[model samples]
Target: MPEIAPLLGETLTSPTAFHAPLHAPHEEDQWWRSSVIYQVYPRSFRDSNGDGTGDLPGITGELARLAELSIDAVWLSPFYTSPQRDGGYDVADYCDVDPRFGTLDDFDALVGRADELGIRVIVDLVPNHCSSDHALFQSALAAPAGSPERAMFIFRDGRGEDGSIPPNNWQSHFGGPAWTRTAAADGAPGQWYLHLFDSSQPDFDWDNPAVRAEFERVLRFWLDRGVGGFRVDVAHALIKAEGLPDWGGRADGGSTEGFPGWEAPMFGQDEVHAIYRRWRAILAEYDGERILCAEASIDPLPRLTDWVRADEMHQAFNFAYLHHPWNAHALRDVISSSLTAFDAVAAPTTWVLSNHDVVRHTSRFGLTDGTPRGGDGIGHGDPQPDLHTGLARARAASLAMFALPGGIYLYQGEELGLPDHTSMPDDARQDPTFARTGGERIGRDGCRVPLPWRADQPSSGFGGADSTAAPWLPQPEGWAGFARDVQAADPDSTLSLYRTALQLRRDLRLGAGSLSWSRPFEQSDVVAFLNGEVLVVLNMGEFAAPLPPGTVIAASTPGAVEDGLLVPDACVWILSTAG
Candidate 1:
């Protein structure tokens, strides 16, 4: 690690960049090679300015909190300039920080401070699409139809006389056609562009060298600004199939819900590999081991690992656990298939239970529908995970994640056992699921509501020191039991569970090996596996299960694993082979 020269300025670099894996001859402390990254959804982290929305400074304010749990890196989701059509996934500018978040200097300070604390910064990099209001989009709109600036996007000629048109049958991620008629006031009115999510976000034309160059510029813009790596968004979708062929006969209600027709020809196509290689080359110029984590969610591990090979991304998220049903046998199946494939390909992978885009884990499992589930709340008793069973479940799940073969990402509020704040009242919705479909999807707002820092106050502890801004989204009543301050002080709190789980991940080399499930604990609802030294057994159910031999190494239930059986409702047993 670089020694800090408090008086120096120009020679300064993010601590992680200077550390650069050179100190450890074999790059041993190159922790991220296999480690846990704590994901912070900025808006809910802390409100230093008391504006109800979290800012970079708020995140900086919480570094000590994270350090206490021993995380390797922090992957911040888009703090760049954006119209936020998809919650900041659409970029308007690559070089500047959004004022709503904080200043560039604030970011630099955050990076420097984190490096000072030995933490790395892996920022979200949105390259596939740009906001409709982006500068280039504006330039393209004002130019001639065939201008090179206009070629930066996929502007197609008008359709046949009937006008049934698109570059392909691909569907947008948010639902709808992937193509939109380009309506540049000064340019051709009949031209079209492809947008895989909101029509406002036009996909870049990878076939255009200039487009690729601009994205490379975007990548360097941050690495130069002190970012350690990137969380490549929609990485697999960065490039579409060459001819934009349709998935013949695989029908569906639309392309968004994975009914199949559009996913194949449009998502994680083999062609995206070239784009990753292109980006990695630019990253290497900054530092040889520059990390790039792909966000591909497709199956058939080889297809996904295509972007995570030795020369490609250092890691690509393995979303099997997130997409699987919350059951023991089901989880075991996905783990077996995924581990086998990922190991065979020699590509590193990662696991994340919750993220800014997914329904909060609590809600995903039907535990949160604005109903009473336990803990200390107004009408409810305590807002915490007060039940013996719920705590066991949460602990087991977290422990299992830590014992996996690669890095694990911890969602912002998972450490506190916070549930999706679904009871925030109707008119206070902040998610597009409700805006776009009139609540057909019930929106992700429930998971995105205000984060509670305390349980003693009306806001459950997350307002200003003088605190009051109505929060960007309403605070869910479920937070009554999971406030940060309350959990921090409680030895038996979920925060404690998280701290223990994360500590174990860092102290053990569980993140660097291969995971292979053994004997298949099918009937027990346990996803059992081996992560190097320890035998990890996860009971997806509330009841306990039998363990093979070794002494219990680390069980989620503080005391759940006694003789051989685990208590029901999420219990984990980490046993040594000797037992």
Candidate 2:
């Protein structure tokens, strides 16, 4: 390891230093282009009512913490009325908050508070599906096959002579058959409904004008409530292929593949663009720079950019970049491809390290090098990660992400370098994937454990000290070391690293700009790139590398630089005044 040194002094010691506005803010309407949005999974963020579940009020209470982190916005995961079948993604009502999360008034308060703190609010919009218990789905079950109610969802007659077979061989993204047969009003078996995800989340028929108009109303309802934008869940899946053709392959559902079946007949269809175009028009009707961001995993890479056309979504999460191994060459390849592709469509590329659906990057990076995708396969019994090495790379990766052009997303607890609670008990798992896969896959529950706010407080300060309720998901025993309070006090903690990186991201004017790779280093594992005047150098190899010729402005790891040497699994920002 290289010798560590303090790069900045008193500025970092003060809490208010991070809140200072950027030296130059981007254009108002183009805020989404280079914004740093933080994603908060409501169930695990904080519990205000002592119900062991997080709520809107809990998120509202943390606005100051977010504002202090220097993030531009917060993208909250679903808090909509649901049956808890797939977290909150299985929306029972689009316009209402789940009673478990809080009331509509609480949501309104959260939005208001976030706005006051200069942090925009972006709610998750699960437009592709709704809970089976939704009034519309219930009505569709009671109504006849040809009834208009049934037309709202993708309902079709079974194929066999006795109509005993599923409508098609399509499999659920979670696991098992995608089609579920419903009993008719008279109690006889009826048509089958398609659900690409969990059975409780029945897929909507986007071709249906009613479905289109209903979501339009949903968007307006939130927009009227002052939400700045939306994160479109499964954005590439709103429009399936017209004929609902078979994928002509095994029923593995591509669940095991790197692309996660994104190119199948059931996802990423060309018609999806039309739906977004209509949504863009509705968003235009609202003021205050409302935007749409797609959670797309579309393949060929460029297809993800299609959802971000000028009149459609403003940004789409770069899953390709997220899935890349911690290799300098691989990271550079994806970054170049994403920038070129999105630039061609005049859309900003959004970079993300971790989210609710995937294993936390800290844990993911800890594993030995391999092509691992999705969050289902690894868990408590899996091989433990090299936490020391993983965290170093995670910090380095975050700096690299912030140095890139366009927007970025920070998942909750990632700032603390929280790893997946890989030892979580199987009985404690609640993800639909776990139940559906019969414990064959562990699911994403490990990463959803409640965050640690204070080291010694009950529920790790996730809930108030007097509150007796346990966290919905148990915190790992090692969480105390990563507690927000602890990290806040320690200047060298990952939490502090994120604070410094985010502050420097704006102070250096790194977000809104074009990017170009600097000349190669002696080591192939070293990646150096220029974001305006800031030369970002990242060493992913095991040995030290020489830093570019410039003044070191920021470093991801504490000992990232010594005697002009860049240490392994580290990143540094250099101010190239002579360039």
lDDT of 1 at 368: 25
RMSD to native for every prediction? 11.0, 5.8
lDDT of each: 0.67, 0.82
For residues 414-468, write the lDDT of model 2, one tens digit per residue.
9999988888888888999999989887888888899988888888889877778
Displacement of the residue 157 alpha carbon in candidate 1, Å: 2.5
TM values, all candidates: 0.85, 0.93
Q: Which regions of candidate 1 fall more than 4 Å away from where they truly are?
A: 1-29, 162-168, 184-189, 246-263, 366-392, 513-524, 530-533, 541-543, 547-553, 562-564
lDDT of 1 at 283: 81
Tens digits of per-residue lDDT for model 1 on 315-405?
Answer: 8887766766667777766666665566655654577777777655554455423343211111122232233444455566777777776
Q: State the lDDT at 323 in candidate 1.
A: 63
Model 2 reaches what TM-score against the true structure? Answer: 0.93
